[model samples]
Target: MKIFELPQTNPLSANRTIPNVDSRGFHYKDFETMKPEDSKLGDAGFYVGIKATCVYHSQTERIALHFLDFNTRVLTMRTHYPYYEEERFAKKYLSKAPIWRKEVATIDIDILYENDDFELAQHGVSCKDKEEEFLTQKVVRRSARDHEFYAGINGTWEPVVKNYFARKEYDNYEFILKHIRKSNVLALNEEALIVSQLWKKRGLKRPMDSLLEPFARKIGTDKHHLFRLTCVAIFLGHLRLDHKYEFNLRTPLRLRPDGVYQFSRGVETAPWGF
Candidate 1:
């Protein structure tokens, strides 16, 4: 089974648009040309959709199933900008002005899955079984972080806020510095709540020491201090929900020294921070 790429569409826009076309369906040239009902799908905010199809080769006795997964990431940067700016204290301290605006984009992930000749009777009496064993399935979901593509960091909550402030208030260095310290306090509070929930879900002790132990080893830092600081960062949105930054890896490594720490795959990282 092979997965074919489906054109991405922005159903949320006033103008309905489709990215590409093959043989699956009729392509709309523009929003105006579409019927009223068809156009409604555009305004519905369902930016992502999927289409799947299957084909068979008679001579080869081979069966193929195609699956397409569509997903969208809606970005809302402006909602957090006020808090971001406050944390940076950019307006008072930075010499340079920061840019405050929201950006939206449609991203796509395409995958393919396949199967060869097989006896149906022996293979659980269904094509799905053959396809399941031989074919690879791909699932696509919205990305948690939006700014990482534009920014160097992986869109950790804290770093994004800091970056925005830094850019906006570069000239007001003193004030920005002060705001960062203050922001840390609020972030930590939120972090504590999130971490506590993670611990409870895992049936672990909720004591401060238990929480601190995993974080300390994960980040390769002082367990108690880092835990306290992390909690503050989360509360302030310094460590954001959509940010990909994380700590708690098997190996002690800092992906972002200034932002949240993330553990890569097969690293035996602790999952408490999620």
Candidate 2:
């Protein structure tokens, strides 16, 4: 099934406001209402915000419910967490506040997931492909507003974990069933998110110099070599992880100030078994 994204703002009604951390959000005081036994110490309980009714269209129409649980005190465009069983969440939290109950809304899953222009609509872009307007004023690029992460490029673990177990099935699925899967498809993966934030804050850019030029003759002109070296430098600059790593080879890699990677002879070769 394709990923479903709930509209951040309430498009159902004009007067409704989206419940976020800053607005009608779950508060630390609200957690006090839950019985101490039901709540754990030092555990930051979740916030149930925007709710949507998802209807699956097929031979037999199926209906499902989903909620966005924005963690307490976290503030970001992608702060909402996906949760199912809206009744369970309501029974636990919404009984106390009547006004907050207004945040819940209904939606069609097919309109959001299967539509061709859903990507453009979700970002609030207002432009039509008009042939008459050649010199139309460009207010902003759609790419700037679109930050949703897909699989593979952003180090998202959902697809990775899914692929690992998908190859084989066992009578005992218990090995993989116990883990809680928090759906985080709305935002970039943790690594890319951090990098993007750092890039904006620090004005970071990939240096366009090659340190592997000296070894280029030996290694030849493989693009992967340059990409690998660039990634190493990027990790060092953005992640604050400068620890030395040993590859399963005789050469030792080092980073140069120009953001290029250099390799030198190691003092000792790896053991044959290694």
Candidate 3:
């Protein structure tokens, strides 16, 4: 399913207004009380924002739902197990919050697992081709407006976690998983052997200028080498190297930087099991 439909919204009619305070407390007025002309959708004279967030696991195609009412600041995040009873998964991942702010929204959503197979077969597949179909699905109809608003925001949570990962020092699979869970970026195996291998060999202390010559030689005549090098640099940066020499060993030979290199003092212990 497309990422955009994960969150869906519907405009409210204009005639709607804040429910009058009564002996019980404040509550929304009934839709029946409003006039037909005033009740037209999108005419809710005042702002009443709603949003829904759904994270889709690329590998398993599972989805987790996070509902938000921008107007009231209420949140209801839950998971539905398609293959099993909804309550089964609900007890584990479902969260109920009356309010959530943008600053902490990413953290809240990150904790929900989007790869639950049972959950995917039930909710994920229903919206596989038409994400907006959830709007009509009774399970999500009550929060359609909220979901739409969330769709409008469009996967902002992933980038936030990725940014955090980009700033940290790379350690092991656990460290990567911490950010990966939050960002939903990389889908490496649990062991992340490739990353571990690169991490182990990344401690060599060669001069940058010397390394550049060999890299340039290996990259000779390949137009795509530049693009590959750029990707390598980004991945290396996420690994958090203090010096350029540390990157040379981890980077593929053809993609190494081809320019002057400066060496810094003080060697840090590498974490890879070589």
lDDT of 1 by residue, 23-102 (tens): 22223221122122432123211211112211221101111111111111111001101112233545535757544432
Model 3 backbone overlap count:
15
TM-score for each of the candidates: 0.17, 0.17, 0.20
With candidate 1 superimposed using the best TM-score fit, by how many Å does residue 184's alpha carbon deviate from the native?
5.2
For this target, which candidate reaches the highest TM-score against the unseen true structure?
A: 3
Model 2 CA deviation exceeding 4 Å by range: 1-79, 82-88, 92-210, 218-224, 236-274
User: How many pairs collide in each candidate, listed in order?
Assistant: 33, 0, 15
Choose the strongest candidate by lDDT. 3
Candidate number with the higher TM-score (2 or 3): 3
- Report the C-alpha displacement of residue 175, candidate 2, in angstroms: 40
Between candidates 1 and 3, the one scoring higher on lDDT is: 3
Error of 2 at 173 (Å): 40
Show the lowest summed lDDT stretch of 10 residues, model 2. 155-164
Order of models, best TM-score first: 3, 2, 1
Cα lDDT tens digits, model 2, 21-118, are 31224332222222213322232233222222211221011111111111111111221222123566577575774434324321111111112332
Q: Report the lDDT of model 2 for residue 168.
A: 16
